[model samples]
Target: MTIGSLLLGSTAALIAVSDARAVTTVAEPDPTEYAKICDVYGSGYVYISGTETCLRIGGYLSYYVGLGDVGLFYHARTSDVRTGEDQGTWQNNTRFTLKAWTGQETELGTLKTYTETRVNFGNRHTSVSDSSRSYAFNGDSILTFAWIQLGGLRVGKDWSAFDMFIGGAGDVLNQTPVPYGALDTNVVQYYFDAGNGFSAVVSLEEGSGVVGTIDNYAPQIVGGLKYTHGWGAITGVAGYDSNYESVAAKVRVDINVTNELLLFGMFGYGSNGKLNDDPMNAIDAHGRGFYKIWGGNWAFWAGAAYELNETTSLNLQLSGDQLKNYGVAANVAYALLPDFTVTAELDYDRYGGSAVGKVKASEVNWTNANKKSSVGGILRFERSF
Candidate 1:
């Protein structure tokens, strides 16, 4: 073979080798991260990327229509309340609540954080300057809960332990027809779960708005103890109102008669004499405190919940205060789907004390206060995720 032919053959061999190398090489796929289910806590939780923490986001949409003397529409109008000029009509409220929960395992225990935000639109409690515009957008708080917990220690905005510990007068739509206790406040609380069936909680709280809030640096104190078993539970709660310098306590007992029936009773006592001193409480004369919200110095509440079936339940509450004020509330809750429920409730209240607000200066009544019997009801629909 000639030298040129030999050189061409070598070039062809080199080209073939280069093409073979190109065909064998492949670019590695870009690194990817996938969401992982974190079932350690429960369903709907996923581990955060690059972290051991688990997060779950959820909320609920609730709609309720109020009728008769319901709390949603019975209050006298701020503009013309003295002459009893009020807007007593059908009222509706729609709320969208968003919630988030984060949890992680730590040496101290479970580190957790929770937040709840709410938005409302409907015929809330507002004076109608333009009679035609009764419905509007309204909300009490955008952020109802923002709390953090390390083990049993929790700090942030939460409902009072006094009301939460005892389950709050059954599952009634109108929890406070006779005013069991205050609901909202900021808290620094600690919980202790004794082995077996005993647990306890102590809380230092900053009371909520106007009449309930603490004026000085001294915080309100509340404590509770509970014992639970298969049959039922016995729970007790007590609170010291720093502002009013009074103490209120409640003791409750629950009995699980059968697999489907549960009965409970609670008794409340408070040094409500201070109520007559404050102008705000003077209107009601029951000495309303953050912890003691009953009509008088003593009160009793009895309630029961019976599971009629898998999808239906019946709940009822009967409450009375020392002043002879009595309330009865009953409701039937039916679950339409996994996360949706509808409840209809009826409430009857017989006012024991005069509703007339007495002015220290004159006998003028501030609100259209009167001792009268009233009937109210609510139809509620809620969907939670």
Candidate 2:
């Protein structure tokens, strides 16, 4: 073969091979469609793709530690009492919460949904039934809030309206928890806005916990009325517990005396009807139900919060019940940074009634008949979005 012909053929063969080895290119997708801001509900919401529904996501993290005297947060575990083991007097906790929100407008009204899930890693409390186990959860993980609302009507799991309408007892870290009236329940509720400064709520609830939950199909009933103004507000709530055929009522007043100072007082009373004296604990001897959480037939709660400055605040709460149960709590909150906060609190409790345990009042650690009083303190650090 001729040199020129051989060179041309080789070059042609190389070109064909190069083309055959070339990588195939797949088709590219179209440009992404940006999400549209949805302002009808609130900030941080964006319209869902291909739909008008608004969606948002948020959460928080918290680290809390506490220590206290006997009968309060710190207690003598069954193991400690039986053996000479080290007393676990401190509680260390870490918690994570996830939340979601959605909103859509409809002919009926504004349709909205909210959900929250909480998980915690901590140590469980053991006054009589258990031994302290390290790194164990104090309580089961929970769906803290899950509810749907269409205008005035709402249904799902949430805090009872009796507490929501009456507001809680200031900002103090009340370790005992009942003074705030922050009880949880599944509810069917309706809200009414009567124009200027007046509103009302009607709720049918299924209570939580063993002693509070209904023993039958009959549901609990609650109603509330509230009036709001520039100088604070006045609110009242009443609940009928079907299980025990008992009734509870609360009245609250809030006075915003100054821009930086806020004060509130609440009084609760109940008819402990249909007493079941079978339980070892006498808490229900007078028929304590879900709505009547305090130790006795009547209880009073008062509290105040003062803004120390732009980044600091102080809070306090005092409460007492007809059964001679008393408690005091105080706290100071400081905003360490934008979305981070640090809070420290002190708590005191005295149980002068037979509501603490199955033991005699003189032998019960919660009773003044033996220990006089119990005290505790906690520190918390939180970050939220």
The lDDT leader among the candidates is: 1
Clashes of each: 2, 0
Give lDDT tens digits, candidate 2, residues 1-385: 9999999999999998887767565556534544678999889898888887899989999988877642344342223556637565577778899999999999999899999999887775544335343445556689989999999999999999988878877786663533435378999999999999999999999988877777788988899999999999999999998877878999999999899999999999877666455565454664467787776567898889899899999999888876567788899999999789999988888766645322333454443454357777888899998
Candidate 2 wrong stretches, greater than 4 Å: 1-35, 70-88, 127-139, 175-182, 277-283, 355-371
Question: Per-residue error at 206 for model 2, in Å?
Answer: 1.1
User: TM-scores across all candidates?
Assistant: 0.82, 0.83
- Give the runs in model 1 whose Cα sits over 4 Å from its true position: 1-34, 72-87, 125-133, 273-276, 279-286, 354-369
TM match of model 2 to true structure: 0.83
lDDT, candidate 1, equals 0.81
How far off is residue 205 in model 2, in Å? 0.8
